[model samples]
Target: MGKATGFMEIEREETIERDPNERIKDWKEYSTPFSDDMMKRQGARCMDCGTPFCHIGMEIDGATSGCPVYNLIPEWNDLVYKEQWKEALDRLLKTNNFPEFTGRVCPAPCEGSCTVAISEPAVAIKNIEQAIIDKGFEEGWITPRIPQIRTGKKIAIIGSGPAGLAAADQLNQAGHTVTVYEKADRAGGLLTYGIPNMKLDKDVVARRVKLLEDEGVNFIVNTEIGKDVTGDELKNSNDAVILCTGAQKHRNLPIEGREAKGIHYAMDYLTISTKNLLDKKINNEGLDAAGKDVIVIGGGDTGADCIATALRQGAKSITQFGKHPQLPVKRGSENMWPAYPQVFSLEYAHKEAKAKFGEDVRQYSIQTKKFVMDENGELESLHTIEMKKTRDENGIFVFEEIPGTEKVWPAQLVFIAIGFEGAEDAIIKEFSVSATSKKIDAEYGDFRTNVDGVFAAGDSRRGQSLIVWAINEGREVAHQVDGYLMGESALPSVVNA
Candidate 1:
C-alpha cells in the first residue's frame, strides 16, 4: 500500500548503529535514530501484494512466522510513506502496546515473512515502527488517555512484565480498576533487569510505566504474591486475577564443579549490572567481570548478552559455547521463507564482541565438559569437547561428543545462559494452579486456570517466547477477563481480530 514501484526503485537501508568499539565503552543504546527522510524511503519499500503475510501472526514449522501483535504493517507503511506520521503512530499503537520494546529487541518475524522478502530484502518495518513511536513521543502526540468511566470491577495482575503491562493497559482502557504487582523493587520485569541496557534503555521502559500510572493503573512494586501477599488474598480482594509472571526458572548446568564460586546465572549477572548502573553503585564485588577471562555456556541471545556485558566490564577475554553447529549463511532448505529464517548473522552484542576482541567470541559445536577449579575451589579453567550433530534411530537430532577433541581453556568467571524451563514451582503451588514442568496449564485462546476468576498468560503459560507474543497474550487475556466480568467485551482479541 506504499508506492507501487518504490520496492523496485529503492534499496533497503537499515537503521545505523554507533561504532561497536566506541559504544562498548558505555551502556547507552547502540542504535542511532533514522532520519525522517530515510524512514519514509524505507517505508516506501512496502509492496502492494494482494495477500500480505507480514501481519498474519501465526506459527509455521514450530516457529513464529509473522508479527505476533498482528501489527498493520502495510497500513502503517503506507501512512509513513505518505508522511502521515500521526496516522502511522495511531495504527502502530492499535496493535502494539510498546513498539519501542519490540522495535529494539524483536527479531522482526514480520520482515522474514514479508512478500517482498521472497525475492529481495523486506521493507524495514521494525525500524519504521520505532521511528513512528519515537516521533510520536518527540512531537508530544502521545499522552495518557484516562478512562472516563469505571466499571467498579477490580483485576489483580501479578507481574510487571510486557504481558502484565499490556493487560493492565487494555483493562484500564476498558474502565476496570487494575493493580499490577511486581516482586522487584522496580517494575518492567525483564525489560528493567533481565536485558542489558545497551539493547534497551531502562528510561524507555520507565516512561511507559509512568504513562500507565497516569492512565489510572496502580502499580505496587517490591511485593511478591505468595510471599509478601498470598495468592488467596488477591483472589478474595479482586474480581479476577491474572498471572503474568514470566518463565524465570533458569536451566542450570549440573556438571562437574557446579558449585564453583565464580559461576553465576546470566540473568543474575545482567540484573546485578543493571541494578548497579541504576543505583549508581561502583562496587560490583565478585560479580564484576573486570580483567577476568569469561566463559559463557549455552549460545543464545542471553549468551551473546553475557559476552557484550563482559566486554563492557573490561574482561580480558570471552568465549561462548554452543552445542549446535553454525547456521548456514543463507536460508536452509528446512527453514523456508515465512518462518523466521535460521541463518548466520551477527547480533549487536556479537558485533561489539568482535569489534573489541578482533574475533567472534562464539564457539559453535562445542560442549562444556566440566568446570575445573583450583585447590581453594575457585574457578580456574574449563574443559570442553567438540561435538558433531547426528540423527538418532527415531530421526531426532542429537549432539555426540568427539572423544579426541577435548581441550581446556583458562577462565576465572562463568555465566550460564542455557535458557529457562518454565514458571517457578513456588508461584504455581501458591496460587493452586495446575501446570506442567514446562508451562502453566491453560489453553491458549482461553487463559483460564483451575481456580475460578483466575487466568494465566505470557511466558508462564506459553514457555519462553518473544516480547510481542507476551503482549498478544496480555491483550487476549484482558478480553477474556472483561467478557467474564461483563458477559461481553468490547476489547479486541489479537488472535480473532
Candidate 2:
C-alpha cells in the first residue's frame, strides 16, 4: 500500500456521471473521466487487506463474489495512489486484456467483496481501473506488443466478443496466428449491439478492435462460421478452433397475443437501434418508440437498457415489470461482508428513467399474462397478474399467482428482457460439439470439447454471464489451446477459485 493509513484517511469517490436529465437526450457515454487528483483519492481508498477478497475470483451463493478475471486490484490501487500509472496499467493488463471495456460495463463484484465495504463504502475500484488504462493511453504507454517469433500455429476463434478477443490476444502473444470470425456486420459481438450505446461508447470498442488488428489478430466480420464458412473448414485450416460465441439465445415469453407486431426481443430492439445509428439512418429503421407507451418485461441490466433506449427514442411513457419481489432496502444479515449484497439499487438506465419520468419505472412481483393487441394487431396493452413466492409440496420455492391481483396496463411497445437461454442451437449443431442444455459440454476449468482440437469458451461454454467471466474463459481457454499446440505452455490461468 502506498500509505499505511490511506484507506482510513480517504473516503471513496466515484466518477462523475453526466446529469441524467441531460444525458437521456442523446445516446452517448454519460460518465466523465475523473481528474488526476480524484483518481488518486479513489485509489487510496483501497485497504490492501491482509486477506483481499476483492480479487479472489470465487463463486459464492451461485454467483461471483469478486473479480472473475483475478485482476490485481490492490496492487494497481496502491500503484495508482503512488502515481505509478504506468506500473498500475502494467499490473492491470497482466490479467485483464480489456480494462477499458470492463471498467465501463462490469458490475464490479470486487467492490462488493472489498474489506473496506464491511464498515463503509467500498473502494472506487472500477473508476480507478478505468483511470489507469485511460491514463496509459493518454501518455502513450500502451502500444502493440507484436511477438518477436512466430510459432507457425494458426488458431480460429468464433465470435469477436470479449471471450474470443481475449483468447485471440493471448494466442497471438504466444506467436500463434489467430483469426476471429464474427457473425455480425461488425466485431465485438454483443458489445457492438446487445448493450445500448449510451452505456459503452462504440468508438471505444472500435479503437480497441483496431488495436487488436495492429497486434496481428485477424478479424473477419459478417462472416459467420458454419454459414459463410464451415466448421469443418475452420478445423481443417487452423491447428485449433475455439468457439467464443456468446449465449445469445433469448428466452421468449409465449403468452397470449404473443404475435403482436409491436412486441420484440430485447436484443432485436437494441440491435436495430444501434445498426441504424451506425449506418447513419435517421428513422431507426422503423423501430422508433416516439410517442408510444412502452413496457419492458423482466428486471435486469438488459431491462433497464430497454427503458433508457425507449426514453431516448421519445417514448411517451415507460414501465418495467419483474416477476420477483423487490429486494430489501439494505443488505440482509445473511449477506454481509465478502458477499455480493442483495439490496435495492439503481443502475445507469434506471437512473435515466427516473430522471425523465419523475419516478422509478419498476413494478415488481408482476407477471405478464398476455400481450393485448389493438384492432390493427399492434400491441396496445399487457394483461398481468401479481405473484408471490411460496413453498410447494416438495418444499421447493415457486412463483404462484395471487388471486384478485390481475390488472391490465396500456402499452404500445413491449420488450422482453428476461435474459438468454444459451448459445444458438444452429451454431452448436454445425460444430457437432457435445452440449448440456444450452451450454457446450466442455470440462470445467478446461474448455476442451469432445471434438479433437475444438474448444468452447465464454457464454458459449458457460451460460449467460458477465463480460468479465467471458474474458476469463477466453484467457483460460487460450492457455489450454496453447499447451495443446506446443505440448507445453507459459500462459497463466486466471481461475484460482
Candidate 3:
C-alpha cells in the first residue's frame, strides 16, 4: 500500500533459482537469495487490496481459501517496499513464527488467494517473505525476543517439527517454560530428513534450531515421550502437554511383491540420504543411484523430489507414475486466477527432470501392480497396469484396471511416495485420547483432549497439511493452554502470518 498504483506500475519478480545441472551436484539449497533491488521491486508489486484476502486465515464456503496463519502479507510487503525491513519483519512475525522456513517451502496459498491475481499476475509474496527473513538474519534483526516475565506455567511439546517449533515459540512467548522433545538424533523433525536437501538446506534448519535453543527454550533430543519419558512423568512435570507430531505414516500401495528388498518407502529413502548428509558427507553415503533405473510412485511433491534427487545422484534413468489424468494446459473457468488454480504446473524437480531427460518423467492414469525382483532379492523391474475410474462396490468411487493394459517396465529400484496416514500410534496411544480414523477427536474451541490438560495440535489434530497450518494450530493451541492455566492469557491466535 506504499504506492496507490504500485500493482499497476510494477511487475512481479520471482527469485532466481540456480541452474539445475550445477545445483544437484551437492547437498545444498538450490534457490538463490534475491538481491536488495530485486526483492524491493517484487515487494512493489503488491496491490495490498481493500479486502486483502491474501492473509485472510479462514474458510470460504467449506473450501480451504486464504492463508493458513493469516500472514500480514500486504503490510510486510509495503514495509519492505518502503525499506523498513525491521518493521516488515515485526509485521511478518506477528502471525507467523517462522517466515524463514515457510517462505521457502510453503505452497503459498496466500498468493493463490491474492486479489491482484484475479486480473494481473500475483504479487511475489513468497519471495518477498523469504527476502525479509533473509535480510533480518543479515542485519541481526532475527534475534530471539524472549518474554520478560515468567507465568510459572510449564508446557511440553512433542515432535520437533515445524508444528512443535511454532507451538514452543508461542507458549514460551506467553512466559511459560517450554520443552520440545524429538525422537530423531537432531532437533528438526521432517525438516531435517523428510525433505530433500536441494529444496531446503539443513544449515537453515540448524540455524533456526540454535536460535530457538538460545531463546531459553529447552530441547530434549533423541528422546520420545512414550518411549523414553513416561506420559505420566511428562503430565506431572508440565502444566499442559501439546502434541505436534506430524502425520508421517506413509499410505502404502497394496500390490504383489510389495515386500521386495529394493522396493522402499520414499520417506525411508529420503531419510537415509538426509541422515547420511548430516552425519557424514552426502557423497560418501552408500545410497548412490548411479547407473540404476528408478521408478517413483505417486505424483505429489515428495514423488517429484525423489525424481530430482535420483537424477542428481546420476541415476541412469527415472520415471514417475500417477493415477489421475493430466490437468489441462490452461486454467479452467472454475480455476481462474487465485483459488490455487488447478492447472498444469512445472515445479523445480519436474523442470530438472525434463531438462536432464528428453521429456517430463510423469505418466498419468498409470498404477503399479507389483514389484518385479531378481533372484537375489534385488529389484529389477516393475509390473504395472493402466487404470480408469469406474463405480465401486458401494457405488462410490473405485479404480478399475483396463484389460490388456498390463506391462513390464525395467526398474532397478522403486519408491512409494504416497502421502501419510496420520501421526505415529505409539505416542497417540500413550496419551490415551479419544480418536478418529485419522486424528484425535478434541473439542474444537479449546483444543483439549478427553484427558484433561493434554492437547493435540497441527497434523495430529487436523491431519497432514501445509506447514503453515501446523504453525496456526500450534499458535492457537498455546493460547488455549495458556488461558486454561492462568485466569486469562494474552497469547495471540492472530491467524495468517
Candidate 4:
C-alpha cells in the first residue's frame, strides 16, 4: 500500500539508541527518535502484498505471528509515505489505545511476519508507528474526547496494566462509567512499576493515564479489591466487573539456599528500583546491586531488564543463567516465515551490559544447582552445571546435566527473572471466579466467567502473554461487556477482524 516499488529501492534502518556507556549513568529512555524523512522512507518500504500477514494477529507453532491488535499497518504505512500524518494517526488509534507503550515495549511481532522479511529486512513498521503517535501528540492533535452521553452502566476494572487501561478506554468511550482499581500507588500496573523507567518512561505512562482520566475514566489507586473493597461489594455497586489483574504470581527456583537474604524476585527488584527513582530517595531503597557481584537466574526480557538495572546501579559484575540453548543466528527450519523468528539478537539491556563489561553476560545451556550463602545467610555464590538438550523416549525435550561440568560463580546479589505463574489465588477465591491452576476460567471471545455480570481478560485469563495480546483481549472484552449491558455492541473487535 506504500510506494509500488519502494521495497526494492529502500533499505531498512532502525531508530538509533543512545550510547550505552553514557546512558548507564542515569535512568532515561535509551532510544532516540527518527527524523521525519527517515520515517517516511521506512514507511514507503511496506510492500503491497495481496495478502498482508503483518496484521494477521494469530499464533503459529506456539509463537505470535503478527500484530495482535490488528493495526491498520499497510494503510498507515501508505499514509505516512504520502506525508498524510493526521490520517496515519487516525488509523493507528483506530485499534491501539496506546501506541506509545506498544511502540516502546512491544517486541513487534508484526515486523517478524512482514512480507518483506521473506527475502530482506522487514519494513520499519514499529518506528513509523511511534513516529506517527509521537508526532500526533507533538502537534497537539490528540485530545480527550469526552463521551457525550452516559449509558448509566458502571463497570469496575481491576488492574491498571495495558489490558485494564485498554478496556477502560473502550468502555468509557462507549459511554459507560468506568473505574479502574490499582493496588499500587499509581494507575499503570506493569507499565508504571513492573517495567523499568529506562525502557518505558514513567512520564509516558502518566501522560496516557492523564488522558484517560480526562476522558472520564476514574482511577482508584492504592486500593486492593479483595481487602480494601470486597468482591461482593464491587459487583453489587458496579453494573459489571472485569478482572484484568494480570499474571503476577512469579515463578521461583526451589534449589538449595533459595531463601538466601540477598535473593529477590525480578518484579520486586524492578518495582523498588522504579519507586526509588520516582521518590528521589537519597539512599538506595530495597535491593541495591551497587558494587556487588550480581547473578540473574532465568532468561527472556525480564532477565535482560535485571542486567540493565544492575548495570545502572553500578554493579561490579553481572551474569545471567538460562537453561535453554542459544537460538540460531537465523530462522531455523521449525521457525519459518510469518511466525515470530527464533534467532539470536542483542536487546537494549544486552548491548549495554556488553558495552560496559566487554562481553555478553548471558550463559545459556546452564542450570543453577544451588545458591551458596555466607554465615549471615546472605548470598555468597552459586553453583551451576552445563546442560545438554536431548529428546527423551516420548520425544519430549529435556535438559540433562553434563557430568564434570559443574562450576561456581561469586554472587553477592541474586535476582530470579524466571517469569510468572498466573493470577494470585487470593483474588480468584475472593471473587469466587472459577480458575484452573494457571489462568482464570474464561473463553477468549466471550470473556465471561461463571459468575453473572463478571468477566475476565488479559494474562489472568490467558496466562503469560505479550502486551499486544493483552490489549487485544482488553478490547475484545469491552465489546462483550457492552453487548451484555446494552443488548448490542458497536465496538470493534480485533478477533472478528
Candidate 5:
C-alpha cells in the first residue's frame, strides 16, 4: 500500500508529545502530531497478514484479541498508507463513532494483536487514526448533517458520557429527536469534567458537542432525572429514555482514619481541578497546585492522570502506589494478543511524571493501613506494611499484609483512584427502577429498565469498562429504543445482545 519496503526500511514513528517540564507549565493537551510523512510510513508498517486478528473483536479460546468496537483497521491503514485522507476518515468512522476521543484515550488493543508486534514494534494505529481525524477537521470535512426526515419520536439519554453520546448520535442520524441530560454543567459528563484537561482539552469536547448540537441533538445541563425531574416525567416527555450515567461511586479503602481533609477521591480531585481550570479560563475562578507533596494511590489511568496533574500543579514531589507488584515490560503468555495484556503499559501522564519528578512512578505493593493524622483532624502521613499474594479460603488469589513489615510515608495530599463500585443508587431508587448487582433489570436481550420506557447503557448497565464498550452499548441500546418507539429501526445493531 505504501513504499514496498516501508515496513523494513522505516521504523515505527510514535506520536509526538511535549516534554514533561514544558507540558506541566500548561493545562492544555500535551500531544503533538508526527509529520504527514512519518504517519504514512507508520501506516505502511501494517503488514498484509493472511488473518488480520486485530479487527475480529472476538473471545476466542478463552483469550481475546481484536478491536472491541470492530474498527476497520486494515482498510484504514491501507488508505493512510496510500495517502487517501478522506477515504481513510470514512472507513475509520464507519465502525468507530468517536475516533477523536478513542484515538486520544483508547489503549488500542489492535496494535497489541498486530502481526508485527510479536517481534517488531506494532505500527502506530492510534496515532494514524488521530492524524486522519485531525486532517478531516483541518480540511473542513467534518460537519453536522441533520437528517432530512424526522421519525417524530423523542429519546431522553440520562448520561452524556461516551455511551450516551454514541447512542444519541446513531439515533439522531436515524431521524429521532435526541436529548442528552448531564448532571454536570456541561454536555460531556466525564470527558468535560472528570478527565484532566492535559489529556483531553475541554474545548475539544465543546467542539464535538457543538457539532452534535448542530446535528439536532438537544443537551440539558445540570439536570438530574430523579431530582430535577422525575423518571416518569422523562418518560412522558420523550418516547424513550436511555440511561448513560456512568458508574461513579468511588471504591473505598475502608481502613481506619479515612476521614481526613487531604484524603480525596480521585474523581473529586479531577472534577474540581477541571472546573477550576475552566472557571479560571472563562470566569476568573481561583485555583492553585503549588509546592505540595502529592501521593496518588491505585496505579490505574486515573492515578497516572493525578500524578501528571500534580506535577503540572508544581508539586514538591509525586508518588504513585499500587496494591499489586510491578508488571513486566511486555505481556506474558497468559496475557497475550487481542486480550488487553495485563502487563505494564505507559501513557503520556507517566512520561510527564517521569520528566517532572525524575521517576516515572514510585509504586509500592505495601500501602496504607490507615491515614495518619496531624493536629485538628488533618492528614499528615500513612501507615503501611509489606503485602503478599496468597490463595484465600475459596482458593482465589488475594492480597494481604505480612507481619513485621510496617512502614510510613509522608503524604501531604492523597488521591484515591480505586475505580467505581456501581452506578449511584439515588437516581435509580427515586425513579423506582430495579437494579441488581451492576445493571438495571430489563428484558433478557432488550435494554428496557423495570421502569417502563427507560433503557440503560454503558457503565450504568455494564459496570466500569472501556470507552469502546460504552460506545458499542450505547449504539445497541439506541437501536432497541428506536424499535420500541417506532416499531422498527434503521439504526445498526452495534452489539449482539
Candidate 6:
C-alpha cells in the first residue's frame, strides 16, 4: 500500500459540488474538479484491505455486495496515490468497459462494501475513478483501437445502452463486424434520454459513441428491429444477433382520474425535456414545469431526476411520494458491512429542493389514492392516504391504508417514476423469443434466447438494473457470442473472474 499508514493519516474528502442554487439554474453537470493533491489525499484514504471486498463482487441476501463491474478499485487507488494516473486508468478499464459512464451515474456499491467503511467512511472510489478517466481524456490517452484483422462474421446488437455498447466494444475488438441498431433518433438509449443531463451530460455519451464508431463499430439510429426491420431480415443479414434493448416499460399508477391531461410518465417527461435542451429551445414545448406545482410519484433515482429536472424548468414547488417508510439514518445490524445498506440519505435533488423551497419535499409511507381533475379534464390535485404495512392471514405483508390520514395536495403536474416493468413486448415478439413475464427468457450466464443464434442481455434479459450490471452482462454475453462464433473464445468474463 502507498504510505502504509495513509488510511490513519488522511481523512476522507468528497468531491466538491457547485452551489445548489447556482447549479439549479442550468442543466450542465454540477461537479467541479478536484485538485491533483486533493485527489491524491482522497486516494490515500484507501486502506487497501487484505480481503478487498471492493473488487470481490458477489450477491448477499439478493443485493449486490460490491461493484457489479468488478473494477480494480484498490489497484487504481494505489496508482492514483503514487501519481501514476495513466496506469490507474489502465487498471480501471481492465474490467469496466466505460468508466466514464459508471464513474458519473453508478450508486457506488463498491463503497458500501469497502473494508474501511466498517469503521469510518469508505474510500472515495467513484471520485478517484472519475479523476483517472478524466485525466486520461485530458491527456488524449483515450482513443479508438481498431482491430488488425476482420473475423468476417457480422453481428447485430439491438440496443445502444451500456450493455449493448460494452458487448459491441468487446466483439469489435475481437475483429468481428459489429453493427448496433437503436430505435431512438440517437444512440446511447437510456444514457441519451432516460437520465438527466446534469447527472450524465449527453456530450459525454456522444463522445464515447463517437469513439466506438471510430473503433469500427457501426451504429444505426432510428431503425428499430421488429418494426423498421423484421427478425427474419436480421437473421438473414447478420451471422448472429444480440438483443440489448433495455427494460423501458414504465410502471403505471392505475387510479381514478388517470386520464387527466397533466399526468405523464417520468421517462417521457425526462426524454422530452432533454430533447428540447439539446435542440437549444427556449421552451420545453409544454413539457416545461415552469410555474407549476409538480408531484413526483415514487422515491427512487428516477423520481429524484424528475425533481431536479423540474427545478431546472422553474417548477414553483415539488414533492416526492414514497410508499415505503423512511429508512434509518444509519445502517441496521441486519444490513451489516459488505451488504448494500438501505439507509436514509439525501440525494442531490432532495438537497436542491431544500435549498430552493426551504423544505425536503418528500413524503414517506404514503399511497396515491387517485388524481383529482378539474374542469376540462386537467389535473388539479392529488388525493393520497398514509399506509402501514401489515401481515394478512397468509402472513404476507401488504399495504394497509391508515384511516383518518387522507389528504389532498395541489399538483398540477404528476410524474410516475415507479420504475420499469420490462422491455417492450413488440420487440420481444419480433424474434419469437420465449419470455418469462415481460422480460426475454434468456439464461443468466449464457444470455442466449430460445431462438437459435439469438441472444439477449441488459435490462431486457435481466430486469431493470444499474448501469454497471448492464455493462457487466454485455461483456459476458460478448464472450459467449465469440465462443459460439469462433468455437473458442478469448474474451474475459466478469462472472468467471
Model 5, 31-106: lDDT tens per residue?
8866788888888888777688777765544434667788888788888888898999999888878888888887
Against the reference, the lDDT scores of all candidates come to 0.93, 0.89, 0.82, 0.93, 0.80, 0.90
* Candidate 4 local lDDT, 1-497, one digit each (tens): 89999999999997799999999998999998779999889988998899999999999989998999999999999999999999999999999999999998999999999999998999998888899999999999999999999999999999999999999999999999999999999899999998899999999999999999999999999999888999999999999999999999999899999988888999899988888899888454448998999998988898899899999999999999889999999999888999999999999999999999999899999999999899989889999999999999999998899999999999989999988999999889989999997699999999999999999999999999999998999999999999999998999985544
The Cα error of candidate 1 at residue 373, in Å, is 1.0
Q: What is the lDDT of residue 189 in candidate 1?
A: 96
Lowest summed lDDT over 10 consecutive residues: which window, candidate 6? 279-288
Instruction: Give the per-residue Cα lDDT of candidate 2 at 192.
Output: 87
User: Candidate 3 residues 1-497, lDDT tens each?
Assistant: 75678888888776698887777677678788788788777777787478887877665534456788888888988888888999999999888888888888888878778888887778888888888888889999888777899888888998888888988988887789999998899988888888888888888899999998888789999897777998889999989998888887778887877777677788888888788777876652335677888889999988988887888779998999999878897667756554675668888888888888869889888988888777877778888889897777787668888989999998877889988888777877898887786687775557888999999888888877888888888888888888899977788865311
> Candidate 2 on 191-253: residue-level lDDT in tens?
889888988889889888999999999999889777799999999999999989999899999
In angstroms, give how far residue 407 of model 2 lies from its true place. Answer: 1.1
Model 2 spans with C-alpha error above 4 angstroms = 283-285, 393-395, 495-497
After superposition, the stretches of candidate 4 with alpha carbons farther than 4 Å from their true spots are 282-286
Candidate 4 is scored at a TM of 0.99
Over the stretch 259-309, how does candidate 6's per-residue lDDT look in tens digits?
998999999999999888888776654677999999999999999999999
- Model 5: runs farther than 4 Å from truth? 1-6, 58-64, 281-288, 391-395, 442-445
Q: Which candidate, 2 or 5, has the higher TM-score?
A: 2
**TM-score computed on alpha carbons, candidate 1:** 0.99
* RMSD, candidate 3, Å: 2.4
Task: Enumerate residue pairs that collide in model 3.
Answer: 69-495, 69-496, 69-497, 70-495, 70-496, 70-497, 71-496, 71-497, 72-497
TM-score winner between candidates 2 and 3: 2
